[model samples]
Target: MVIAVVADIVGSRKLDDRTSAQRILDETIARVEADLPLAQQPLTPTVGDEQQGVYRALDDALVSLLMIQLRLPDGIAFRFGIGIGAVSAVESVHGELADGPGWYAARAAIDTVHAKEGRAVPGARTWIVGAPGQDEVMPSTIAASNAYLLVRDELVGAMSERERRLTYGRLIGRSQQELAADEGISQPSVSKSLRSAGSAALLDGVAALRGDSA
Candidate 1:
Protein backbone atom coordinates (compact mmCIF):
# COMPACT_ATOMS: atom_id res chain seq x y z
CA MET A 1 0.00 0.00 0.00
CA VAL A 2 1.07 3.59 -0.54
CA ILE A 3 0.48 6.37 1.96
CA ALA A 4 0.70 10.09 1.26
CA VAL A 5 1.13 12.81 3.86
CA VAL A 6 0.43 16.52 3.57
CA ALA A 7 1.53 18.63 6.52
CA ASP A 8 1.17 22.40 6.86
CA ILE A 9 2.39 24.74 9.53
CA VAL A 10 -0.38 26.51 11.43
CA GLY A 11 -0.31 30.31 11.47
CA SER A 12 2.24 30.69 8.71
CA ARG A 13 1.63 34.42 8.52
CA LYS A 14 2.69 35.00 12.12
CA LEU A 15 5.83 32.93 11.59
CA ASP A 16 6.68 34.94 8.47
CA ASP A 17 7.84 37.85 10.65
CA ARG A 18 10.57 35.72 12.18
CA THR A 19 12.56 34.39 9.19
CA SER A 20 10.31 34.31 6.12
CA ALA A 21 9.19 30.83 7.30
CA GLN A 22 11.76 29.15 5.04
CA ARG A 23 13.88 27.97 7.96
CA ILE A 24 10.88 26.53 9.75
CA LEU A 25 9.62 24.92 6.56
CA ASP A 26 13.00 23.43 5.85
CA GLU A 27 13.30 22.20 9.41
CA THR A 28 9.89 20.53 9.28
CA ILE A 29 10.62 18.86 5.95
CA ALA A 30 14.04 17.71 7.10
CA ARG A 31 12.55 16.34 10.29
CA VAL A 32 10.04 14.23 8.35
CA GLU A 33 12.61 13.08 5.81
CA ALA A 34 14.99 11.92 8.52
CA ASP A 35 12.24 9.97 10.27
CA LEU A 36 11.16 7.96 7.22
CA PRO A 37 12.26 4.33 7.65
CA LEU A 38 13.05 3.72 4.00
CA ALA A 39 16.10 5.70 2.92
CA GLN A 40 15.00 5.56 -0.71
CA GLN A 41 11.68 7.30 -0.17
CA PRO A 42 11.78 10.67 -1.91
CA LEU A 43 11.02 13.91 -0.08
CA THR A 44 8.69 16.14 -2.11
CA PRO A 45 8.99 19.88 -2.38
CA THR A 46 7.18 22.35 -0.17
CA VAL A 47 4.56 24.70 -1.62
CA GLY A 48 4.46 27.77 0.55
CA ASP A 49 3.69 26.45 4.05
CA GLU A 50 2.70 22.93 3.02
CA GLN A 51 4.83 19.83 2.47
CA GLN A 52 3.92 16.49 0.93
CA GLY A 53 5.61 13.09 0.80
CA VAL A 54 4.83 9.45 0.24
CA TYR A 55 5.65 6.11 1.89
CA ARG A 56 5.22 2.47 0.95
CA ALA A 57 3.62 1.50 4.23
CA LEU A 58 0.77 3.05 6.18
CA ASP A 59 2.48 2.37 9.48
CA ASP A 60 5.61 4.21 8.43
CA ALA A 61 3.59 7.14 7.18
CA LEU A 62 1.64 7.38 10.43
CA VAL A 63 4.84 7.24 12.48
CA SER A 64 6.31 10.06 10.43
CA LEU A 65 3.33 12.28 11.22
CA LEU A 66 3.60 11.60 14.94
CA MET A 67 7.30 12.35 14.94
CA ILE A 68 6.75 15.67 13.17
CA GLN A 69 3.97 16.70 15.53
CA LEU A 70 6.03 15.91 18.61
CA ARG A 71 9.18 17.62 17.41
CA LEU A 72 7.71 20.90 16.12
CA PRO A 73 8.84 24.08 17.87
CA ASP A 74 6.64 25.79 20.44
CA GLY A 75 4.09 28.39 19.27
CA ILE A 76 4.12 26.48 16.00
CA ALA A 77 1.78 23.56 15.30
CA PHE A 78 0.95 21.35 12.31
CA ARG A 79 -2.06 19.83 10.64
CA PHE A 80 -1.65 16.61 8.69
CA GLY A 81 -3.80 14.85 6.12
CA ILE A 82 -2.94 11.21 5.35
CA GLY A 83 -4.30 9.08 2.53
CA ILE A 84 -3.59 5.39 1.90
CA GLY A 85 -4.22 3.64 -1.40
CA ALA A 86 -2.69 2.18 -4.52
CA VAL A 87 -0.43 4.36 -6.64
CA SER A 88 -0.59 4.16 -10.40
CA ALA A 89 2.39 6.41 -10.98
CA VAL A 90 4.95 8.45 -9.06
CA GLU A 91 6.90 11.06 -11.05
CA SER A 92 10.49 10.28 -10.20
CA VAL A 93 11.99 12.73 -7.65
CA HIS A 94 9.05 15.10 -7.51
CA GLY A 95 6.44 12.64 -6.14
CA GLU A 96 3.77 14.10 -8.40
CA LEU A 97 1.18 11.51 -9.41
CA ALA A 98 -1.82 10.96 -11.65
CA ASP A 99 -5.26 11.17 -10.02
CA GLY A 100 -6.54 7.95 -8.46
CA PRO A 101 -8.41 6.73 -5.40
CA GLY A 102 -5.32 7.48 -3.38
CA TRP A 103 -5.33 11.10 -4.46
CA TYR A 104 -9.03 11.44 -3.77
CA ALA A 105 -8.61 9.86 -0.36
CA ALA A 106 -5.81 12.28 0.42
CA ARG A 107 -7.96 15.23 -0.54
CA ALA A 108 -10.74 13.93 1.69
CA ALA A 109 -8.34 13.56 4.58
CA ILE A 110 -7.14 17.11 4.07
CA ASP A 111 -10.69 18.33 4.12
CA THR A 112 -11.38 16.44 7.30
CA VAL A 113 -8.37 17.95 9.05
CA HIS A 114 -9.27 21.42 7.86
CA ALA A 115 -12.82 20.98 9.07
CA LYS A 116 -11.45 20.23 12.49
CA GLU A 117 -9.52 23.49 12.45
CA GLY A 118 -6.14 21.79 11.93
CA ARG A 119 -6.26 19.76 15.11
CA ALA A 120 -4.80 16.47 13.92
CA VAL A 121 -4.61 14.39 17.03
CA PRO A 122 -6.67 11.78 18.84
CA GLY A 123 -10.09 12.38 20.35
CA ALA A 124 -11.88 15.38 18.95
CA ARG A 125 -8.61 17.10 18.20
CA THR A 126 -7.74 15.32 14.96
CA TRP A 127 -9.87 14.16 12.08
CA ILE A 128 -8.97 11.23 9.81
CA VAL A 129 -10.15 10.60 6.27
CA GLY A 130 -10.05 7.07 4.91
CA ALA A 131 -10.78 5.23 1.69
CA PRO A 132 -12.80 2.12 0.76
CA GLY A 133 -11.45 -1.22 2.10
CA GLN A 134 -9.71 0.78 4.78
CA ASP A 135 -11.84 -0.79 7.51
CA GLU A 136 -8.83 -1.78 9.61
CA VAL A 137 -7.13 1.60 9.31
CA MET A 138 -10.03 3.96 9.95
CA PRO A 139 -11.26 2.61 13.26
CA SER A 140 -7.78 2.52 14.76
CA THR A 141 -7.09 6.13 13.86
CA ILE A 142 -10.39 7.23 15.35
CA ALA A 143 -9.94 5.23 18.55
CA ALA A 144 -6.43 6.48 19.10
CA SER A 145 -7.52 10.07 18.56
CA ASN A 146 -10.24 9.62 21.16
CA ALA A 147 -7.91 8.09 23.72
CA TYR A 148 -5.34 10.86 23.28
CA LEU A 149 -7.94 13.57 23.71
CA LEU A 150 -9.15 11.91 26.88
CA VAL A 151 -5.68 11.89 28.37
CA ARG A 152 -5.02 15.48 27.34
CA ASP A 153 -8.22 16.74 28.86
CA GLU A 154 -7.64 14.82 32.07
CA LEU A 155 -4.14 16.21 32.49
CA VAL A 156 -5.16 19.77 31.76
CA GLY A 157 -8.20 19.60 34.01
CA ALA A 158 -6.53 18.28 37.14
CA MET A 159 -2.88 19.21 37.05
CA SER A 160 -1.71 21.51 39.86
CA GLU A 161 0.35 24.61 39.25
CA ARG A 162 3.60 22.74 39.82
CA GLU A 163 2.41 19.79 37.80
CA ARG A 164 1.41 22.04 34.92
CA ARG A 165 4.84 23.63 34.91
CA LEU A 166 6.58 20.29 34.73
CA THR A 167 4.20 18.86 32.13
CA TYR A 168 4.52 21.83 29.80
CA GLY A 169 8.25 21.81 30.36
CA ARG A 170 8.54 18.21 29.20
CA LEU A 171 6.09 18.67 26.33
CA ILE A 172 8.06 21.66 25.10
CA GLY A 173 11.37 19.75 25.35
CA ARG A 174 12.80 20.91 28.66
CA SER A 175 14.90 18.35 30.42
CA GLN A 176 13.90 17.22 33.88
CA GLN A 177 17.07 18.75 35.29
CA GLU A 178 16.33 22.05 33.61
CA LEU A 179 12.72 22.08 34.78
CA ALA A 180 13.88 21.14 38.26
CA ALA A 181 16.37 23.96 38.41
CA ASP A 182 13.82 26.44 37.13
CA GLU A 183 11.13 25.18 39.47
CA GLY A 184 13.54 24.74 42.41
CA ILE A 185 12.65 21.07 42.65
CA SER A 186 14.79 17.97 42.45
CA GLN A 187 15.11 16.14 39.16
CA PRO A 188 13.66 13.09 40.79
CA SER A 189 10.76 15.15 42.00
CA VAL A 190 10.11 16.42 38.50
CA SER A 191 10.19 12.89 37.17
CA LYS A 192 7.98 11.64 39.94
CA SER A 193 5.24 14.16 39.35
CA LEU A 194 5.35 13.62 35.62
CA ARG A 195 5.07 9.89 36.00
CA SER A 196 2.41 10.15 38.66
CA ALA A 197 0.33 12.39 36.43
CA GLY A 198 0.74 9.83 33.67
CA SER A 199 2.35 12.30 31.30
CA ALA A 200 4.63 9.73 29.69
CA ALA A 201 1.84 7.21 29.58
CA LEU A 202 -0.36 9.81 27.95
CA LEU A 203 2.18 10.34 25.22
CA ASP A 204 2.19 6.64 24.58
CA GLY A 205 -1.57 6.74 24.37
CA VAL A 206 -1.43 9.46 21.74
CA ALA A 207 1.13 7.59 19.69
CA ALA A 208 -0.99 4.50 19.93
CA LEU A 209 -3.85 6.54 18.50
CA ARG A 210 -2.44 5.92 15.04
CA GLY A 211 -2.11 2.57 13.18
CA ASP A 212 -4.56 -0.17 12.20
CA SER A 213 -5.22 -1.17 15.78
CA ALA A 214 -6.64 1.06 18.47
Candidate 2:
Protein backbone atom coordinates (compact mmCIF):
# COMPACT_ATOMS: atom_id res chain seq x y z
CA MET A 1 0.00 0.00 0.00
CA VAL A 2 1.24 3.46 -0.85
CA ILE A 3 0.49 6.67 1.05
CA ALA A 4 0.11 9.84 -0.95
CA VAL A 5 0.39 13.28 0.63
CA VAL A 6 -0.95 16.45 -0.94
CA ALA A 7 -0.26 19.81 0.66
CA ASP A 8 -0.92 23.45 -0.08
CA ILE A 9 -0.28 26.76 1.60
CA VAL A 10 -3.38 28.15 3.27
CA GLY A 11 -3.16 31.72 1.99
CA SER A 12 -0.55 31.89 -0.73
CA ARG A 13 -2.54 34.11 -3.04
CA LYS A 14 -2.96 36.75 -0.38
CA LEU A 15 0.75 36.99 0.35
CA ASP A 16 2.17 40.32 -0.73
CA ASP A 17 5.41 38.53 -1.52
CA ARG A 18 4.28 35.21 -2.95
CA THR A 19 7.81 34.06 -3.66
CA SER A 20 8.66 34.08 0.02
CA ALA A 21 5.97 31.51 0.67
CA GLN A 22 7.15 29.41 -2.22
CA ARG A 23 10.73 29.58 -1.02
CA ILE A 24 9.76 28.51 2.48
CA LEU A 25 7.60 25.70 1.06
CA ASP A 26 10.41 24.50 -1.15
CA GLU A 27 12.80 24.46 1.77
CA THR A 28 10.28 22.59 3.89
CA ILE A 29 9.75 20.00 1.18
CA ALA A 30 13.46 19.52 0.87
CA ARG A 31 13.86 19.06 4.61
CA VAL A 32 11.02 16.54 4.83
CA GLU A 33 12.11 14.57 1.83
CA ALA A 34 15.64 14.38 3.11
CA ASP A 35 14.57 13.27 6.57
CA LEU A 36 11.93 10.69 5.65
CA PRO A 37 12.19 7.44 3.78
CA LEU A 38 10.03 8.45 0.85
CA ALA A 39 8.97 6.33 -2.05
CA GLN A 40 11.00 6.41 -5.21
CA GLN A 41 9.03 9.44 -6.28
CA PRO A 42 10.02 12.41 -4.15
CA LEU A 43 7.83 15.41 -3.52
CA THR A 44 7.22 17.50 -6.61
CA PRO A 45 5.49 20.79 -7.13
CA THR A 46 2.08 20.85 -8.75
CA VAL A 47 -0.04 23.55 -10.22
CA GLY A 48 -0.75 26.59 -8.09
CA ASP A 49 0.78 26.51 -4.61
CA GLU A 50 0.55 22.78 -3.95
CA GLN A 51 2.92 19.83 -3.73
CA GLN A 52 2.55 16.06 -3.52
CA GLY A 53 4.74 13.18 -2.41
CA VAL A 54 4.66 9.49 -1.54
CA TYR A 55 5.70 7.90 1.73
CA ARG A 56 6.30 4.29 2.66
CA ALA A 57 4.99 4.71 6.18
CA LEU A 58 2.11 6.66 7.71
CA ASP A 59 4.15 7.71 10.72
CA ASP A 60 6.78 9.26 8.50
CA ALA A 61 4.11 11.27 6.71
CA LEU A 62 2.66 12.43 10.00
CA VAL A 63 6.03 13.58 11.22
CA SER A 64 6.62 15.46 7.99
CA LEU A 65 3.22 17.15 8.24
CA LEU A 66 3.89 18.39 11.77
CA MET A 67 7.38 19.53 10.87
CA ILE A 68 6.15 21.50 7.91
CA GLN A 69 3.26 22.94 9.87
CA LEU A 70 5.54 24.29 12.58
CA ARG A 71 8.21 25.53 10.22
CA LEU A 72 5.96 27.65 8.04
CA PRO A 73 5.86 31.36 8.87
CA ASP A 74 2.79 32.79 10.56
CA GLY A 75 1.19 33.99 7.33
CA ILE A 76 1.78 30.69 5.53
CA ALA A 77 -0.20 27.95 7.16
CA PHE A 78 -0.49 24.51 5.54
CA ARG A 79 -3.24 22.04 4.79
CA PHE A 80 -2.34 18.39 4.19
CA GLY A 81 -4.29 15.50 2.68
CA ILE A 82 -2.99 11.97 3.10
CA GLY A 83 -4.39 9.13 0.97
CA ILE A 84 -3.85 5.42 1.41
CA GLY A 85 -4.50 3.31 -1.67
CA ALA A 86 -2.81 1.98 -4.78
CA VAL A 87 -0.60 4.09 -6.95
CA SER A 88 -1.31 3.07 -10.53
CA ALA A 89 1.27 5.37 -12.04
CA VAL A 90 4.65 6.68 -10.95
CA GLU A 91 7.18 8.22 -13.28
CA SER A 92 10.77 8.13 -12.11
CA VAL A 93 11.76 10.57 -14.82
CA HIS A 94 8.89 12.91 -13.96
CA GLY A 95 7.68 12.53 -10.40
CA GLU A 96 4.98 15.15 -10.79
CA LEU A 97 3.16 12.94 -13.30
CA ALA A 98 2.46 10.24 -10.71
CA ASP A 99 -1.23 9.38 -10.39
CA GLY A 100 -3.45 6.62 -9.12
CA PRO A 101 -6.19 5.78 -6.62
CA GLY A 102 -3.89 7.07 -3.91
CA TRP A 103 -3.35 10.34 -5.71
CA TYR A 104 -7.07 10.79 -6.36
CA ALA A 105 -7.89 10.09 -2.71
CA ALA A 106 -5.24 12.59 -1.63
CA ARG A 107 -6.79 15.15 -3.95
CA ALA A 108 -10.18 14.45 -2.38
CA ALA A 109 -8.73 14.75 1.11
CA ILE A 110 -7.30 18.21 0.40
CA ASP A 111 -10.65 19.31 -0.94
CA THR A 112 -12.27 18.09 2.27
CA VAL A 113 -9.84 20.09 4.39
CA HIS A 114 -10.45 23.17 2.28
CA ALA A 115 -14.19 22.78 2.70
CA LYS A 116 -13.83 22.44 6.47
CA GLU A 117 -11.62 25.52 6.56
CA GLY A 118 -14.31 27.46 4.68
CA ARG A 119 -16.77 26.41 7.37
CA ALA A 120 -14.46 27.97 10.00
CA VAL A 121 -13.50 24.67 11.54
CA PRO A 122 -10.71 25.46 13.94
CA GLY A 123 -7.35 23.91 12.94
CA ALA A 124 -8.72 21.87 10.09
CA ARG A 125 -5.35 20.99 8.69
CA THR A 126 -4.48 17.32 8.15
CA TRP A 127 -6.92 14.84 6.60
CA ILE A 128 -6.77 11.28 5.34
CA VAL A 129 -8.81 9.27 2.85
CA GLY A 130 -9.13 5.62 1.97
CA ALA A 131 -11.62 3.30 0.29
CA PRO A 132 -14.15 3.28 3.09
CA GLY A 133 -17.12 0.99 2.65
CA GLN A 134 -15.33 -2.35 2.37
CA ASP A 135 -12.48 -1.56 4.72
CA GLU A 136 -13.36 -1.67 8.38
CA VAL A 137 -9.90 -1.41 9.88
CA MET A 138 -8.79 1.36 7.56
CA PRO A 139 -11.86 3.46 8.25
CA SER A 140 -11.48 3.12 11.99
CA THR A 141 -7.84 4.02 11.77
CA ILE A 142 -8.62 7.05 9.68
CA ALA A 143 -11.21 8.18 12.19
CA ALA A 144 -8.74 7.91 15.04
CA SER A 145 -6.15 9.72 12.97
CA ASN A 146 -8.55 12.58 12.32
CA ALA A 147 -9.36 12.86 15.99
CA TYR A 148 -5.69 13.08 16.83
CA LEU A 149 -5.03 15.61 14.10
CA LEU A 150 -7.82 17.91 15.25
CA VAL A 151 -6.31 18.38 18.68
CA ARG A 152 -2.73 18.36 17.45
CA ASP A 153 -3.27 21.13 14.91
CA GLU A 154 -5.22 23.29 17.30
CA LEU A 155 -2.60 22.98 20.01
CA VAL A 156 0.19 23.82 17.63
CA GLY A 157 -1.71 26.76 16.21
CA ALA A 158 -2.34 28.12 19.68
CA MET A 159 1.34 28.11 20.60
CA SER A 160 3.49 31.20 20.68
CA GLU A 161 6.56 31.33 18.45
CA ARG A 162 8.79 30.32 21.36
CA GLU A 163 6.45 27.52 22.30
CA ARG A 164 6.32 26.34 18.73
CA ARG A 165 10.09 26.22 18.47
CA LEU A 166 10.28 24.24 21.68
CA THR A 167 7.56 21.86 20.52
CA TYR A 168 9.21 21.35 17.16
CA GLY A 169 12.51 20.62 18.80
CA ARG A 170 10.83 18.11 21.06
CA LEU A 171 9.14 16.46 18.09
CA ILE A 172 12.51 16.10 16.39
CA GLY A 173 13.97 14.42 19.50
CA ARG A 174 15.85 17.36 20.91
CA SER A 175 16.05 17.17 24.67
CA GLN A 176 14.57 19.92 26.84
CA GLN A 177 18.06 20.83 27.97
CA GLU A 178 19.18 21.21 24.38
CA LEU A 179 16.15 23.30 23.58
CA ALA A 180 16.88 25.51 26.56
CA ALA A 181 20.38 26.11 25.31
CA ASP A 182 19.08 26.80 21.82
CA GLU A 183 16.61 29.34 23.14
CA GLY A 184 19.04 30.85 25.69
CA ILE A 185 16.61 29.96 28.47
CA SER A 186 17.04 27.82 31.54
CA GLN A 187 15.99 24.19 31.44
CA PRO A 188 13.27 24.93 33.97
CA SER A 189 11.87 27.58 31.67
CA VAL A 190 11.84 25.06 28.81
CA SER A 191 9.75 22.68 30.92
CA LYS A 192 7.43 25.54 31.83
CA SER A 193 6.95 26.46 28.18
CA LEU A 194 6.15 22.89 27.26
CA ARG A 195 3.63 22.63 30.04
CA SER A 196 1.89 25.91 29.30
CA ALA A 197 1.72 25.28 25.56
CA GLY A 198 0.31 21.78 25.96
CA SER A 199 3.28 20.42 24.10
CA ALA A 200 3.34 17.42 26.40
CA ALA A 201 -0.25 16.63 25.58
CA LEU A 202 0.57 17.03 21.91
CA LEU A 203 3.30 14.46 22.28
CA ASP A 204 0.85 12.11 23.87
CA GLY A 205 -1.44 12.63 20.93
CA VAL A 206 1.40 11.87 18.58
CA ALA A 207 2.17 8.72 20.51
CA ALA A 208 -1.45 7.69 20.17
CA LEU A 209 -1.44 8.51 16.50
CA ARG A 210 1.63 6.36 15.98
CA GLY A 211 0.20 3.55 18.12
CA ASP A 212 2.90 4.07 20.69
CA SER A 213 0.60 5.00 23.55
CA ALA A 214 -0.55 2.37 26.00
Candidate 3:
Protein backbone atom coordinates (compact mmCIF):
# COMPACT_ATOMS: atom_id res chain seq x y z
CA MET A 1 0.00 0.00 0.00
CA VAL A 2 1.07 3.59 -0.60
CA ILE A 3 1.02 6.15 2.20
CA ALA A 4 0.53 9.85 1.57
CA VAL A 5 1.64 12.45 4.09
CA VAL A 6 0.47 16.02 3.82
CA ALA A 7 1.28 18.71 6.35
CA ASP A 8 1.08 22.48 6.82
CA ILE A 9 2.66 24.98 9.14
CA VAL A 10 0.58 25.51 12.23
CA GLY A 11 -0.44 29.09 12.90
CA SER A 12 1.34 30.25 9.79
CA ARG A 13 -0.51 33.52 9.58
CA LYS A 14 -0.03 34.52 13.21
CA LEU A 15 3.68 34.97 12.87
CA ASP A 16 4.80 38.56 12.30
CA ASP A 17 7.39 37.17 9.92
CA ARG A 18 6.72 33.79 8.40
CA THR A 19 10.05 33.50 6.64
CA SER A 20 11.97 31.99 9.55
CA ALA A 21 9.28 29.45 10.32
CA GLN A 22 9.11 28.52 6.67
CA ARG A 23 12.83 27.97 6.63
CA ILE A 24 12.68 25.75 9.65
CA LEU A 25 9.79 23.77 8.25
CA ASP A 26 11.54 23.29 4.95
CA GLU A 27 14.73 22.18 6.66
CA THR A 28 12.89 19.84 8.98
CA ILE A 29 10.92 18.29 6.13
CA ALA A 30 14.07 17.77 4.13
CA ARG A 31 15.76 16.18 7.12
CA VAL A 32 12.79 13.90 7.62
CA GLU A 33 13.01 12.82 4.00
CA ALA A 34 16.71 12.02 4.29
CA ASP A 35 16.30 10.20 7.58
CA LEU A 36 13.15 8.27 6.68
CA PRO A 37 13.91 7.59 2.99
CA LEU A 38 10.64 8.05 1.15
CA ALA A 39 9.95 5.26 -1.28
CA GLN A 40 8.20 6.98 -4.18
CA GLN A 41 8.11 10.77 -3.78
CA PRO A 42 9.90 12.91 -1.25
CA LEU A 43 7.88 15.39 0.76
CA THR A 44 7.72 18.49 -1.42
CA PRO A 45 6.46 21.95 -0.58
CA THR A 46 3.22 22.56 -2.43
CA VAL A 47 2.16 26.00 -1.35
CA GLY A 48 3.64 28.62 0.93
CA ASP A 49 3.99 26.37 3.94
CA GLU A 50 2.27 23.18 2.95
CA GLN A 51 3.96 19.95 1.84
CA GLN A 52 2.93 16.58 0.42
CA GLY A 53 4.79 13.31 0.13
CA VAL A 54 4.28 9.66 -0.75
CA TYR A 55 5.95 6.75 0.97
CA ARG A 56 5.93 3.12 0.07
CA ALA A 57 5.08 2.09 3.62
CA LEU A 58 3.01 3.41 6.49
CA ASP A 59 5.94 3.02 8.88
CA ASP A 60 8.13 5.41 6.92
CA ALA A 61 5.46 8.07 6.79
CA LEU A 62 4.61 7.88 10.49
CA VAL A 63 8.23 7.79 11.62
CA SER A 64 9.07 10.76 9.40
CA LEU A 65 6.33 12.82 11.02
CA LEU A 66 7.44 11.82 14.49
CA MET A 67 10.97 12.95 13.72
CA ILE A 68 9.73 16.25 12.38
CA GLN A 69 7.58 16.86 15.45
CA LEU A 70 10.46 16.25 17.81
CA ARG A 71 13.03 18.36 15.99
CA LEU A 72 10.91 21.43 15.33
CA PRO A 73 11.62 24.64 17.20
CA ASP A 74 9.22 25.58 19.98
CA GLY A 75 7.83 28.24 17.69
CA ILE A 76 7.29 25.80 14.85
CA ALA A 77 4.62 23.17 14.43
CA PHE A 78 2.70 21.37 11.69
CA ARG A 79 -0.37 19.21 11.33
CA PHE A 80 -0.20 16.01 9.33
CA GLY A 81 -2.68 13.92 7.37
CA ILE A 82 -1.67 10.39 6.39
CA GLY A 83 -3.62 8.22 3.98
CA ILE A 84 -3.09 4.68 2.81
CA GLY A 85 -4.22 3.17 -0.49
CA ALA A 86 -3.14 2.38 -4.04
CA VAL A 87 -1.52 5.04 -6.20
CA SER A 88 -3.60 5.21 -9.37
CA ALA A 89 -1.89 8.07 -11.15
CA VAL A 90 1.56 9.58 -11.00
CA GLU A 91 1.28 12.99 -12.62
CA SER A 92 5.01 13.70 -12.37
CA VAL A 93 7.96 11.51 -13.22
CA HIS A 94 9.00 11.15 -9.58
CA GLY A 95 5.61 10.58 -7.92
CA GLU A 96 5.55 14.27 -7.00
CA LEU A 97 2.15 14.57 -8.69
CA ALA A 98 -0.27 11.90 -7.54
CA ASP A 99 -4.01 11.47 -8.05
CA GLY A 100 -5.76 8.62 -6.33
CA PRO A 101 -7.87 7.55 -3.36
CA GLY A 102 -4.77 7.76 -1.18
CA TRP A 103 -4.35 11.45 -1.86
CA TYR A 104 -8.08 12.06 -1.42
CA ALA A 105 -8.19 10.24 1.90
CA ALA A 106 -5.09 12.12 3.04
CA ARG A 107 -6.68 15.45 2.14
CA ALA A 108 -9.80 14.41 4.02
CA ALA A 109 -7.74 13.42 7.03
CA ILE A 110 -6.09 16.85 7.38
CA ASP A 111 -9.50 18.51 6.94
CA THR A 112 -10.73 16.59 9.96
CA VAL A 113 -7.77 17.80 12.00
CA HIS A 114 -8.82 21.39 11.33
CA ALA A 115 -12.45 20.87 12.33
CA LYS A 116 -13.78 20.89 15.88
CA GLU A 117 -14.93 17.58 17.25
CA GLY A 118 -17.51 18.13 19.99
CA ARG A 119 -15.64 19.37 23.12
CA ALA A 120 -12.42 17.69 22.07
CA VAL A 121 -9.23 19.75 21.87
CA PRO A 122 -8.88 21.50 18.52
CA GLY A 123 -5.22 20.70 17.88
CA ALA A 124 -5.36 17.08 17.00
CA ARG A 125 -2.47 17.75 14.68
CA THR A 126 -2.04 14.36 13.10
CA TRP A 127 -4.62 12.03 11.57
CA ILE A 128 -4.88 9.06 9.21
CA VAL A 129 -7.50 7.78 6.79
CA GLY A 130 -7.36 4.49 4.98
CA ALA A 131 -9.17 3.32 1.89
CA PRO A 132 -12.41 1.32 2.14
CA GLY A 133 -11.82 -1.79 4.18
CA GLN A 134 -14.36 -3.84 2.26
CA ASP A 135 -15.91 -4.12 5.76
CA GLU A 136 -15.80 -1.83 8.86
CA VAL A 137 -12.06 -2.09 9.40
CA MET A 138 -11.17 1.42 8.28
CA PRO A 139 -12.95 3.41 10.99
CA SER A 140 -11.53 1.52 13.92
CA THR A 141 -8.01 1.72 12.56
CA ILE A 142 -8.22 5.44 11.98
CA ALA A 143 -9.68 5.96 15.44
CA ALA A 144 -6.83 4.12 17.11
CA SER A 145 -4.21 6.01 15.13
CA ASN A 146 -5.74 9.43 15.84
CA ALA A 147 -6.11 8.65 19.51
CA TYR A 148 -2.37 8.09 19.68
CA LEU A 149 -1.59 11.21 17.67
CA LEU A 150 -3.75 13.36 19.93
CA VAL A 151 -1.96 12.25 23.06
CA ARG A 152 1.42 12.50 21.37
CA ASP A 153 0.74 16.07 20.25
CA GLU A 154 -0.22 17.08 23.77
CA LEU A 155 2.88 15.48 25.21
CA VAL A 156 5.23 17.20 22.79
CA GLY A 157 3.40 20.46 23.14
CA ALA A 158 3.98 20.41 26.89
CA MET A 159 7.75 20.05 26.69
CA SER A 160 10.33 22.78 27.24
CA GLU A 161 12.95 23.51 24.60
CA ARG A 162 15.65 21.59 26.43
CA GLU A 163 13.33 18.70 26.97
CA ARG A 164 12.40 18.70 23.31
CA ARG A 165 16.01 18.50 22.22
CA LEU A 166 16.71 15.65 24.57
CA THR A 167 13.60 13.85 23.42
CA TYR A 168 14.54 14.37 19.79
CA GLY A 169 18.02 13.02 20.34
CA ARG A 170 16.65 10.08 22.26
CA LEU A 171 14.10 9.35 19.57
CA ILE A 172 16.87 9.06 16.98
CA GLY A 173 18.80 6.59 19.16
CA ARG A 174 21.42 8.99 20.50
CA SER A 175 22.97 8.04 23.78
CA GLN A 176 22.48 10.26 26.76
CA GLN A 177 26.22 10.67 27.18
CA GLU A 178 26.61 11.72 23.59
CA LEU A 179 23.74 14.16 23.82
CA ALA A 180 25.13 15.59 27.04
CA ALA A 181 28.45 16.23 25.37
CA ASP A 182 26.75 17.87 22.42
CA GLU A 183 24.83 20.18 24.72
CA GLY A 184 27.86 20.81 26.94
CA ILE A 185 26.04 19.43 29.92
CA SER A 186 26.69 16.56 32.26
CA GLN A 187 25.20 13.20 31.45
CA PRO A 188 23.01 13.34 34.53
CA SER A 189 21.38 16.52 33.31
CA VAL A 190 20.61 14.98 29.95
CA SER A 191 19.22 11.93 31.68
CA LYS A 192 17.11 14.17 33.89
CA SER A 193 15.70 16.03 30.90
CA LEU A 194 14.66 12.81 29.23
CA ARG A 195 13.25 11.33 32.41
CA SER A 196 11.39 14.46 33.41
CA ALA A 197 9.87 14.66 29.93
CA GLY A 198 8.87 11.01 30.07
CA SER A 199 11.15 10.18 27.19
CA ALA A 200 10.70 6.44 27.55
CA ALA A 201 6.99 6.68 26.99
CA LEU A 202 7.43 9.10 24.11
CA LEU A 203 9.95 6.87 22.41
CA ASP A 204 7.75 3.84 22.89
CA GLY A 205 4.76 5.69 21.50
CA VAL A 206 6.72 6.64 18.38
CA ALA A 207 7.93 3.09 17.96
CA ALA A 208 4.38 1.85 18.24
CA LEU A 209 3.26 4.43 15.70
CA ARG A 210 5.71 2.89 13.26
CA GLY A 211 4.07 -0.48 13.98
CA ASP A 212 7.33 -1.67 15.42
CA SER A 213 5.42 -3.17 18.32
CA ALA A 214 2.42 -5.39 17.69
Best by TM-score: 2
Which ranges in model 3 have alpha carbons more than 4 Å from their true place? 90-97, 117-119, 133-138, 209-214
Query: lDDT, candidate 3, residue 209?
Result: 71
TM-score for each prediction? 0.61, 0.87, 0.85
lDDT by residue for model 3 (53-140), tens: 8888766676677778888888778888888876666667665456788888888888878873334766578889887642377577
TM-score, candidate 2, is 0.87
| lDDT (10s digit) by residue, model 1, range 32-53 | 5654443125345456666666
Q: Write the per-residue lDDT of candidate 2 for residues 162-201, one digit (tens) a residue.
A: 8877887887678999999988999999999999999888
Model 2 RMSD, rounded to 1 decimal: 2.7
Q: How accurate is candidate 1 locally (lDDT)?
A: 0.59
lDDT of 1 at 97: 59
- Poorest stretch of ten by lDDT in candidate 3: 115-124
Using lDDT as the yardstick, the better of models 1 and 2 is: 2
In model 3, the Cα lDDT at residue 15 comes to 80
